[model samples]
Structures are given as structure tokens and as C-alpha cells.
Target: MVVLRTGPVAVGGVTLGNHLILAAGVLGTTGASLSRMLARGAGGVVTKSIGPEPKNGHAGPCVAVLDNGILNAMGLPNPSQDFTGELGSLGQKPVIVSIFGGTPEEFAEVAGWFKGTAAGFELNLSCPHAEGYGAAIGVDPVLVEACTRAVSTLGMPTWVKLTPNVTDITAIGKAAERGGATAIVAINTVKAMRISTALRRPVLGNRYGGLSGDAIFPVAVRCVYELFESCKIPIIGCGGVSTADKVVEMMMAGAQAVEIGSAVQRDIGIFETITNELYAKKGIEPGEIVGCAHE
Candidate 1:
């Protein structure tokens, strides 16, 4: 059996059971859904990436699946902070608020709100489909550093989620490290789109969307490995993980924890299914798969 190896994995002073983490997903968009994930045994929860203010985001048909990944153009539509405040008191599970903004100051302000409440903060530095700020911040090392530093003063673990569209993911990875990020979430969705040839338009309403799914697993793994090779910090892997086997693969690639983005919609009980499999395979504990690659 794959017994989960035990170790201390602390983020901003909160110790998680093991490295088995559920990545941020749609469930995180609402406080009710977040509470349920905790009930289902997720180590912690990352809110759906939010912007500084309420955003209408893109219209429906925002998400599409590609051969290897999923494409999403959801405009980061989120209930405003005032409406989401109840999230702070919803459950005991550590909450790592994910926020996006057009400038460093805006991100810092968002970080400021989470002080004394959220367990950590993950800056959505990369979101392929969002306009201006999403992928733009991640492609430039200087901007990445500036944005990270701006939010560093929040006195919590700040993780910069990177984009895969860059030429060298490691460059921005290291830049974030230099800017004082506590850890790195190795990748946001990759940009890809499906088009409607008959309509002479993109399949998604936004004309383009991010691609994420089983097909992107290899790409996610490679990006995680490359970031691990370049920097020494806990890495949060997200993308195309729908089973315990994929979870193990991510651990071997050096992810301290993994996120379950689009997979939440794959099956309502998928988390329990995968968690049971991990335990059945002797991976009940978190960080247990740290050295799985060498074995």
C-alpha cells in the first residue's frame, strides 16, 4: 500500500497534514463550496482568483477543453470583497486567498485586506485569458518582482502563480523568489483556443481562453521540475490532475502540494475518489511522495 509519508509542511505558520492539496477550483468561487471542500478533506482552499474590484469577467461559454488542456476566458468574475468577507469565517481549513490586480499597489491593497484572516495569499500573476494584467505581469521578471514585493508586507506566505506562456518559466520563477515570495505555484492555464469555422469566430465568447486538462499534465510536470531546478521553495502544482497517480507524478516533479482547478467539475466526488486512492496506494499523508521520483 502507498502509505503517506509524514512531515511538517507549514505555510504562514499553519501546518498541513501532508502534501496532498486540492488546487484552487470553481468550488472556491463561493464560500459555501469552499466549506464543502474542507468537509471533503482538502488540506486547504485557494479562492478562485479575484481581482481588486468586482469584475463581470467574460460571458458564459468561457471555458473550453482542448486535446491536452482546458481553455478558460472567465474574466475573473468574482463577488466583491465585501460579499466574500464571510469566507474568512467559513471553515477551519486554511484559506489562501488568490487575487489579481492591474498594478502592484492594487495587489498590495488586496493583500492588506487578508491580513489577520487568510492563511496565505497567492497572486494571480498569470492568467492567459484575462486582459492586460494577468499574463502580462508574469512575462516580465521586473514586474513579477515588483508585484511580489508589493504584497510581501502582508506578513503571510505569498505565492506567485506563474503562466506557462513564457519562454523561460524559470526566469519569472526566480524573479518572484527575489521579490520575496514565500513559495511558487508553478503555472496558471496555458493560452489556447477553439474556433468555430462556420461562424468564423472563436468558440469561446472571449475569442480566446486558457487550456487545462489531462493533456496538460506533462507540460505542468515539466514546468514544476524546471522551477524546482531553478529555485529552492515549496511549489504548488496545478493542471490536468484527476487521479492519485497524477498526484504522485506531481510530487515527484517537486510540487510541495498540488491544486485541483478544472477537475472539480469533472466529478463532484472526485476529491474523495482521488484521496481514497492516494491512501489506498499508501499516500494518505501529504509530503510522503517527496522522493517518489528517485524511487
Candidate 2:
């Protein structure tokens, strides 16, 4: 048996066995896949960012792997918060409902949909190619703060997901804190572009997309570190984390937990492998390692 040394971490009143969490991706856009991931041993799961109602999103070939990370312009395609109540019936694992809205009131409405479900809410104010409500709200500290505070009154953990494209990430990180966020998911995808020599145009149909993967590690680390020094709430470090060492690095930067985004491209078992490897090497239970590096 693999003795995993993950580490104890708490978010919104729930104790996580380990710090490893799967970031929101295409999985939860559908109910079936979301059900499968919860069964696969993921400590916590973030649903793909959803809007108040249905959104068709941008066109695909949505994801393109670059030399470093992956660029995607999925445009926050989701079934909206209407189906969120059903999430509470999924299973035992904590469910964090990721949401996007055009206004503070709209965000509150979407968040309220989880009144009887979801352990928390992740405010996705940062998606590069997502139309209208994506990166716009995140670029403004006041807007981010307003939205965070609006949903926070629900008595559930509210996390503001920040965008790295900004020159100063700490500003927004602090703003999220001021608005009473339980946590902040640092460094959402950076705006990026790729050109195809054959096509002589942008590779992604959306022209620009959010970048994620190993390429984003340095930036994500800096943002996490900055927030650690500036804010008191727990931080969920995400972006470009593919190995156990990177996971440890994020912890040192003051992240209470780490979310693996593009690493899923490696394999579904990649998370299990990394957690098992950390466990084998440290000879500690997964819960014992959560934010050890930072402490």
C-alpha cells in the first residue's frame, strides 16, 4: 500500500487529507465526468467556471500545447448554476463551484444557487479569451472585491481566482482578501498567442487564450509568494505544477493547497503518482505535508 505523505490542510471548515487538488477543467462541464473524478480519489474538485445561465463559449480546437504550457480558449463553456444543486448529491469529496458573472449581483445569484450544496465558490474573474465577463472583472481590484464580498455572505468559502496577466498581482490578491475571501487561487492563465506557419494565422481559433503548464510555474510562484506576504487567508497555488517538487515549491510560497491543471495531459494517474511518490519519499501520510514547506 502507498503511504502518502500529503499533509493536513483546511479550507472553509473542511479538512483535506492532502493538499493535492484537481483544478477546474473540462471534466465538470458534464455531470458524468464530474462524477467519475470524484470517485477517482481527488481530495477536492473545482467545477469548470459557470455563468448564471448557459453560455455557448468560443469555438475549438480550444486547447493547444506549446513548448511550455497549454493555451486554451474554451470561453467558460458551462451548463450554468442551474445544475449546481445536483452537485451536492455527488459524493463526499468537497465540491467547489466555480462561477463567472457579469456583475456583482449576478455573481451572488450564481453563488446562491449553491445555498444547500457546494463546499465553496471560486470566482473566476480571469479567463483571457472568455468574452465580456472573463478577465475584465479581475483586472479591477474594486470589482473583484465587490464580487467576493457579495458571495462571501453566504457562509461558504469564497475564493477569487486571479489573473497573472496583470503587472501587479498582489493588488488584486489583497483586494480579494479585503472583500472577505476565505482563499485565493493565484495566477490564472496569462494571455498568450501562437501562430501557425502553415496557416499563417493564430493557432487557437480565439486568437488569444489563457496559457497554463510548466511554463507558468515561475510566474505562479511569484504571485503565491507575494500573496503569502500580503494576505492572511489560505492560498491555493495553481498553474504549471507537474511534479512533486513543484508542488513543494508552491507550498514554500505559502500555498495551503496546490491544484494540478495541465498535468492531466500527462495521465489521469499522474496526480496519484505524484502523491504516492511524495508519500514514499517522505514516509509521511499525505495530510502531514500540506503546507510544510512554507511553515
lDDT (tens digit, per residue) of candidate 2 on 224-256: 988888888888999998887887778767887
* Candidate 1 segments exceeding 4 Å error: 6-8, 11-14, 65-69, 280-288, 291-295
Give the backbone clash total of model 2.
Answer: 14
Model 2 residue 59 lDDT score: 85
Reference-based TM-score, model 1: 0.91
Model 2, position 290, has a per-residue lDDT of 45
Q: lDDT (0-100) at residue 83 of candidate 2?
A: 71
Per-model TM-score, in order, reads: 0.91, 0.91
For candidate 1, give the lDDT: 0.77
